[model samples]
Target: MAFLPTSYEEMKQAGLDSVDFVYICGDAYVDHPSFGCAIITRTLEAFGYTCAILAQPDWNKDEEFLQFGEPRLGFLISAGNIDSMVNHYSVNRRRRDKDNYSDQGIMGKRPDRATIVYSQVVRRLFPHANILIGGIEASLRRLAHYDYWDDAVRRSILIDSQADLLMFGMGENTIIEVADALNSGMKIQDLVYIRGTAWKTKSLDSIFDDYIVLPSYEEVKTDKYAYAKSFMIQHENQDAIQSKMLIEPYDGWYVVVNQPPLPLSQEEMDFTYSLPYERTFHPKYTYIPAIEEVQFSITSNRGCFGNCAFCAITSHQGRIISTRSVESVVEEAKTITKMKNFKGYIHDIGGPSANFSRPACDKQREYGACAKRECLWPRKCPNMKVDHSHYVEMLDAVRELPGIKKVFIRSGIRYDYLMYDQDDTMFDRLVQYHVSGQLKVAPEHVSAEVLDKMGKPRKELYFKFVDKFYQKNKQFNKNQFLVPYLMSSHPGSTLKDAIELACYLKKIHHTPKQVQDFYPTPGTLATCMYYTEMDPRTKKPVYVAKTYHEKLEQRVLMQYSYPKNYALVKKALIKAGREDLIGNGPKCLIKTYPPRMVSKKKSSKKHIDK
Candidate 1:
């Protein structure tokens, strides 16, 4: 049933004639054609070795491995689209029989099911291959990690995954150097000298000396509940220092951290946009029935300017938006139309902060000048600039392309930046050409303190933009709706904040059913704050959301439209001192919450008395 050559022997006979020096196999989501994979594979291509991307392959099945016959199998490279280290830790922690493992203040929680399954498969299929694992997940867990979910300290994923080397950070430069060395007949052991990778060394006889020493499973396994609490208190600043402790050796397997964030140059951006992207969905995989079926993707830019405390983009791509040219983007659009399966609409064309076409500050010369901890809050950056001409042109070209009916801006666009448009022309253009009934924007949180902590715009700005957006829609007779993305239980959020946000939503009469809970990801500032009460590097006391009730309230307030949620919303409002909004108020939930609550409270009292 697998789409592979008949057998391993058959694959062997097919030979290395068509083989490339390296074969990359891993999660396709991270090795996205526009982002991670494009950068890595192109970089390897630059070094004169043919590198084939076996993206999201079923490494667990022997048949999947046979599709690409052995090409000397230089090194197995994996980094993008895998589970976050925190997610992995959470899985391990949850498996433990302990109540001490809590969600804490993490955001973007996803299961590590793929990585665990894939790693096992790769270990079995490619026993002789030099397996190198890196990416956000592997990098963050390169050293001994105290998994809050697992409630115990765990060893590095590299050792457990059976990878030969582990490269960390943005792997473009490091992966290139690695491929070049291997092509030159250098041994895998020789790759330890690289600055941005983690690998085992022959000299590492006893234990990894560079990483922070954590309690072994044996020491903490029996009393893990107590051990987790102690570990949380002791390593409160673990997130910030976690990356710093990974050391680089002069010669052997070492961990690389603190490498200056790599901003894709204009040329690199052009190359990415130049790739032959068949914007049409692959029909064979279309039966899976997901958004990818109706939607197509194109990257207008790479990286983001908003370095929110909870985000890994700043750490990974740095706070710079490298954009592609209008011509190149149009060319890709044209190619999409030529495809037989083309549905005539390109769903999304943007990347980390789509509105950030060109960064306000020149990072190369003015790196330290833009070192402010937050960008979206306070709006103090005089350097903040907007270039909508390219976007305008790109949208125009996309519309003009044959068979393409609509081009949706599916990715998150910075509302604050978009608001800065001198005129409503961009919004007008978006309404006229881009939107498909709904436009998505992430307001994150409405509470000022919470927004500040999350490095997002003030609540007022979100409302202001919503008003303006709707005003434009009404003026243009457009039926498009605005969908705001909200994050709950961030580091500084509380029940009061959640209640205030809920009240605001009620005031606007806006109800969004899809809201995400904050899942702390690795290498993010927010995660560090969650893990340790202090800034991992600064060791300064910071506000953190630790209670479950507050988290629940935050979630309930975000979607208080349903009758079932009215009591919860009213309770949250009352708890937050916003009882005035409870009944017959502009945002009153009396119609939904009042009747149910009175009867429920009486029933509860009756039960208590009995």
Candidate 2:
């Protein structure tokens, strides 16, 4: 199979004077469906268009971006599979040492905020090209929102990037419409009515449809209450069928986002995956750490309805689940078996949530997700349809394939939804064949108050799931474990809450090796809470562990069993008035002596020796 051109020589060898689009990216050119740049380029090729890739162009020099030259149509830009800021820095805002998307996991290949930087560079060169930016960075920052890196509200990325249009969400269908419009001699300015897109305009006179004008950028920037109110409105209007156009005003121009694209149908999903994909990184690099996990994996579905507070899936992919047909997934599995390094195993056959292979309910699929409530949070909606029979059947089919020995589900599974399913067939199958000794599930926190803020189910639900998992393991005579994903320092989690979590961890005899601190990324409800110190949905005051020391203590509490964390954990326990946990009791988190006292005793002995 021939790969798309990424340099001038390759473009010429392919015998193309000028291509339909010049796709610029902040990631190495990996021609796999998992990467957004690859999908868009391949999809355009299938639809009678020529495209060349400019992956990870050097932002400081014009030569890197000029390699592919100006395109016949426009330039399509993405900040790779991950947001550039998140990839470059940690929650502590410390520069990260490795970039998985870069060649050899090296850092500094791409700039921080690569999308804006690349777009600005291209704009300077091309000046009049149709610049369209999308992917996680553009999608989440489509409107005026909070930027964690800047530590303040930022304008819409479209305005900053000076792009003609911004495609939000999974833009397979959206890109096709855009290409068709541009091909028919339509200017980017005239393509405003397209769904699943946001653009910057100077006037609201052309907006003839029903729309809601959000609080002006200035208002949300200054007033936390206005910011919360603005976020609540956007969250409610995320549905495709029932959503109206949303407009956000700036000083002179405005950012208008059209209703999201409808979720892909089964046939459409099949077609998208069926396109030609090299399914590996380009030959230029000997290694790319990002490919190791996904090289053998298959994305069976897209989109998520499990609207966790910290996740940005609802903002980017929306809350509707769209899955591929069983045949399509099986075909992809067959392809995997024939690859150069074929193994008898399929690493994963999953998506956002493995078991969520269908919509939450018939009403959600036909009408739209309910604006007032989440499908599985605060309690599963009465109308929610909880079943796993089809998922079980698909897994059975995949595992039974010719060269497949095992098909594992590695994506996060919604334990609450799994428990809600009446049929134990999928649950039985999961325990029987799917799990790899341990299944990972996210039970972000144990305290009810913190879980409510995180939109996770009650701790009681997690305990129930744990008991049922072990019961199934015993029934099948297998020794399996449940590795619960824990989070620390999320909004509404205080010192007392952290101590309670530590006590729960002590009771369970499981201390997580790695605990994630809450990162205030854009377009997430939890981020809003972290910044505003209030639940945007209810407008109620919420506590946030904003101080560095408090965040450190919370993280230490989760991993309190480690020898190095003794001092911090002891300090946290004492500060929370839970000094009872410091002594050597059966349920105590740490030993009696603080590390400081031990150090002081050692120092005294050294002084006497001197």
Residue 157, candidate 2: Cα error in Å is 0.4
Question: Against the true structure, what is each candidate's TM-score?
Answer: 0.75, 0.97
How many pairs in model 2 have backbone atoms within 3 A of each other, for residues 3 or more apart or on separate chains, i.e. clashes? 0
lDDT of 2 at 116: 93
Task: Compose the digit string of candidate 1's lDDT tens values, residues 188-288.
Answer: 86665665666654445544345543344344334434334323332332222222233323223433333333555677667755644333222233221
Q: Which runs in model 2 stand beyond 4 Å of their true positions?
A: 594-610
TM-score of 1: 0.75
Q: In candidate 2, what are the lDDT values of residues 347-387, reduced to their tens digit?
A: 88888898999899988788988887988889999988998
The best candidate in terms of lDDT? 2
Report the number of the highest-TM-score candidate.
2
Give me the overall lDDT of model 2.
Answer: 0.89
TM-score of 2: 0.97
Superposed on all Cα atoms, the candidates' RMSDs to the truth, in angstroms, are 8.7, 4.9
lDDT of 1: 0.58
